[model samples]
Target: MTTNNIDILGLAEINVNKNMLRILEHMVQDKFKLYFTTEGKKGTGIRFLVKKEFAVYVQQFQHFEGRIGFIDFYTKKKKIRIIQAYINVQDKEKPQVKRLYKQIEHWTNQCLNSFVKDIIIMGDFNTKWNEYEFLDISHWRHDIFNYFKKHFIKESTLVFCDDISDMYTYIPNNPNHSHNKIDYIWCNIDLMLSAIDSKPRDVQPVIKTDHRMITLDLFMDDIVINKNNTQKCQPSSKTIYCYDEMQKTDGEWNWDKFNKDIIEYLDNPNIKLTTNKIRGINSHKQLNQLWNLFRKAIIHSAKCNIKQKKMKVKQNCHPLYDSDLKRDLNMLKGMLNKIHGTKLDFNDRSIENRQKIIAHITALYRRSDGNKSNTLSDFISITKRHNIIISNHFLHNKTFQYKDILQDTIIILESKYINATYEYKKNIMNTFIQERNQNYKTDKKKMIKSVLEQPHTSLSIDKVYKNDNNKDTFYTEENEVKEQTNLHFQMIVSAINCEKDLSQHPKWQDQYQSKHDVQHTIYSDLMK
Candidate 1:
């Protein structure tokens, strides 16, 4: 029976910080059979109030936060489905307001699913009709009006109040703004006809709220007449018109169940997870941790590469240059050859070799510096020679190209390595914890004794080397020692391999080589 489109904004302002509670109070005071709010955050704040009579058979209620200020309420009304809501203004070109308008359109489009019956959309639409019988507005407003037209939501004022003298349902409180008809109540034509007899009188209520409250009444005359005539009709032959109001239907759709099903499908190790499944939890802590580690590795590798380059520069600028620098020159040339057009081959071995060579050269230069008799020219000559080698290598292979290829390849390799390492580390950590837990359970007494035992310095050799004639204890001790050693070795090997793999990764070549003129040109154009 409730048909008035209430201005929740006015209610919100009155309650201010206590908006939710205040709205609840208002619904109670007005004896609202059903209620909804657009101000709710993510639909959590939305509340639905039902009269006691109606609440009994009301199986479930559902609401969705739609575009703009819109919230769609779905309810089982006497077993018949109904959708109710207000729409926000759609003005998509005005810099500050386009986003809100687009959101409304999105919601409207989503609501086009056919299951909802008796769709009644009513609210304060801060807009005017496109083809007005009297006034003209901007083209953008007309465009918005056309959008509604396309959606088949006819202008409510034009359809319902065309014959009325005072067609306007809204009054501008501000003197500067124009007075226009902006409020409306709209429904499908068939539903509108069915409720014609119950229409409310046109005397708008001037409550504490700013906007005038209008209402539509739904008459139950047919229902009353049928009930009265039921005395003469046989119970078996009688048709039940109000039975829908007494029956309960299915509950509202559970989106959480759907989400849970999706997550299970993806996280199930037995089942193969797809790309679509992974996209669901983008900001999950586990995935974020992996990504963070990968990012850090990339940054560390880049820093190492940069440091090597800087060192090479310094070496080139050294004053004491070798007259027969051909040996050093050949080494540099050979390194460049291995790297040329091979961006993806720099694994642990290559990285270790590069680092070792850089360290050796740096140490030599440092030793030379420590010698008091060494002059600035000695350092400058050495540095200049190295620089020449590097410069030549850069020019010959087209420095930009190789550098780009190397950078890209390194990034890709690092990301893959990080992902693999994360899983490996997780597994190892879990195993270690499990083993410790098992030891605590099986050998609690011995573990305690070991902790309380005298220090190795204080213990006599005889006590330390006591022969455990008991086979079980000796076997247990041996197995424990072997297990501990194996675990330690595994940890050491994993750590070493991880470091070696990362250092030797040839990903930088891909990044380095791809930065050449040809690639750069293409990249620049794409960016533009």
Candidate 2:
């Protein structure tokens, strides 16, 4: 579990099932959303927890037989891929290790083919670096490094930290065992270079886990609206306010009509009072009815005021100036659109042209002193201000707060929202599968013809069995394959048998509870 402020969290091992996952979602649905892969039998798995703000941007998730989890998503229009893996602990499990690497290679190639360049791979490799006896390690760190290097990914620990080899990410409780760094975060070379800053955080041993959590922050250049503006585009807050538009008011409230309605309600003979409830009210149901009466009165007043305001003469505040500014902005965008429509190569000349147009637009909104207006520095500034106005109109207006009732309402609504979302995603996946199957059926003939024209074969092996002395070591191919298969199966079984029970003490719960309590208090206070 992670604090709500974190944008992304990667959890290596956890026992989570569909029902349990739904419960987790219900708890954090308002703040974060989850995507995961679980080993079915035990529900032991890895999960990628993305903050709600970033959930919509997650385009795809790839789960690899419960060993790896990958996500492809966009942030500020930048396509980035994240891969989290938990490798085997045994040294002799070469087949598993190779399979993991093959998956990485396949994913990297797939991303490249799709033109998504930036990638970050992180997780527990279960191997420590040994400069003197690298060959003795089961899950060789050198091989891992070499494999990543081939895909142009560099370990962030080594790239961003000094004396990287001396850093310890995992520490065993046993006195005889020494601490060593095995977990890692790797990023594409280009992404690293483009990042404005990158660093790692060390965890204290008191955290209760044998492996210290590794956190890396890679800040990229801010997205600016134009060359003339220096301001950055910040993401908007998730909290939004909505109000009923049909209840608009333009004049002062009709107090007489409102008073008459309240009088009639109070004089109704059907109304009853009982001693068990507060202030002679029968139950919460009666209190709610009174609250609704008050609400109706307030809304009626606002609507009457809105009608009066609508009758007044409208004011024209710099109509010509505003219109001209908007026209200039649209014309600039049109020019850019025309250039894009031409399908010209993105060479220096085209880029220069684009810059010139942007600068010209910036000049239109420049201040009298020949400096750009602070509010117009970025497009987001305008949208941000609009949102602020709307939120203020809804939130700052006088309102009532019923703590226990409101909290209960929020919990109920969140549960329904999350369940609906889950079902929606499930429906989308089902539709996609059905459509894919139908397409395959429709293209069967063409696919078969293409396959017949260019028959596929197994890829070439990098190494084959050989005799060092050039002696004849020939053996039956069938027997050799069988022996290799048996060896792989035996290694897997042995590794499973040797696996340690790494579950933490039940008392070692995530610090999320206290933090969530604080957040709830703050939110409740704000609502009040």
Best by lDDT: 2
Across residues 261-308, which tens digit of lDDT does each residue of candidate 2 receive? Answer: 555655554552334434767688878987776676556644543233
Every model's TM-score: 0.32, 0.41
Off by over 4 Å in 1: 1-15, 19-23, 26-50, 55-112, 130-138, 141-145, 155-157, 174-178, 197-206, 219-528
Over 378-424, each residue of candidate 1 has an lDDT whose tens digit, in order, gives 32343465442223243224423433333333333334433554566
Clash count for candidate 1 is 53
Error of 1 at 527 (Å): 99
Q: How does candidate 1 fare on TM-score?
A: 0.32
